[model samples]
Target: MTDILVSEIMNRLNSLFPSVSSELNSINDYTFLIAVLLSAQTKDKRVNIVTKELFKVASTPVQMLELGLDKLKEYIKTIGLYNNKANNIINLSKILIEQYNAEVPLDRDQLELLPGIGRKSANVILNKICNAPYIAVDTHVARVSKRLEFTKNTKVNKIEEDLYKVIPSEYHTIASNLLVMHGRYTCTAKNPKCSKCILKDICNSRNKYF
Candidate 1:
């Protein structure tokens, strides 16, 4: 798509989702990081359901360590990959306390160094917390970007790179969340609600369901 079309898509997205943000429920920075980590391969609704109880008992790194590994697993067992997630959460919590004084790192490199925090997770943290211009390409973001012709790449990193090049910097921070919301609701993988979509007139996807 041309830059003008991309700009119009962004404008529509911003108008549709004026308050772009994650749906994961978190009380603080520590809980927010943990919520995002636990959200891997899991739905935000599921993550929120588990974290509601998990955070009550262990909202901080020190509290997480005190909660112990096995107990933490019990709380998040309903989530996929709970065993590995529990282990990473514990280990990352230790790193946070020992290295950063129990504070979530604002730097992308430092955040990525934490257990279970990949580029996508780090991008989310940096964008949401630090208000940085980083687009975290999740499944929804990737699908929407491809269908919109914002990118032809299948790899998330490449898609993110394409978005950075295509989307104006002013909308960079909100791009991921906006696209995520759009894909999750309007431009779904199965039978997308193209008729109700703001970009329906412009979108020429084969999957469109009018």
Candidate 2:
């Protein structure tokens, strides 16, 4: 049952968005992790805007530490939770320099130990940088998965487990990208474009709500 649903959604997503990946607009692990952390409760466009400026000044752990929390806060002031995120970034940068030799830890466990890096953020880092088969369940993934009947639970871990069970191993890397795009553009939280959605036939939330 789960496999069938996964196949249906994958097919529809492939047709809708052929090229989908980290639209956070980053090129390296450091930038990617920073972007993901700043993206908490913030939009990709905003994250991109801040990261563009932040990275120019501090792209490495050494540079980040030098920038200091106060300066970092100023740069990312537009993002949500700027104060907390600034502290996390500073602490995480210190950890990276002291423990990991200024390198982003590849191990998910180690990554999670960083101040701002949670399970989802760690998963994003591992999947994007280390090619690990991890699904980071953000708001978009959670909403889309529930609406598509992939899972009835709102718990992020449960949704991730269900997604792994349903989606094919081959598609895991692309699945995150595809689902994120679907949620952002078509299956939005408010006023979803169901009429324009290619998965209108399979999406459980479409006709049932409208």
Q: How many steric overlaps are in each model, in order?
A: 0, 0
TM-score for each of the candidates: 0.97, 0.95
Pairs clashing within candidate 1: none
Per-model lDDT: 0.93, 0.86
Candidate 2 residue 59 Cα shift, in angstroms, is 0.4
lDDT of 1 by residue, 155-175 (tens): 988998999999999999899
Worst 10 residues of 2 by lDDT: 201-210
Q: Clashing pairs in model 2?
A: none
Best by TM-score: 1
Residue 158 lDDT in candidate 2: 90
CA deviation > 4 Å runs, candidate 2: none
Q: Estimate, for each residue in 105-176, the C-alpha lDDT of model 2 and write its tens digit.
A: 899889888998999999888888877889889888899888888788888989999889878887787777
Residue 114 in candidate 2, Cα distance off native in Å: 0.7
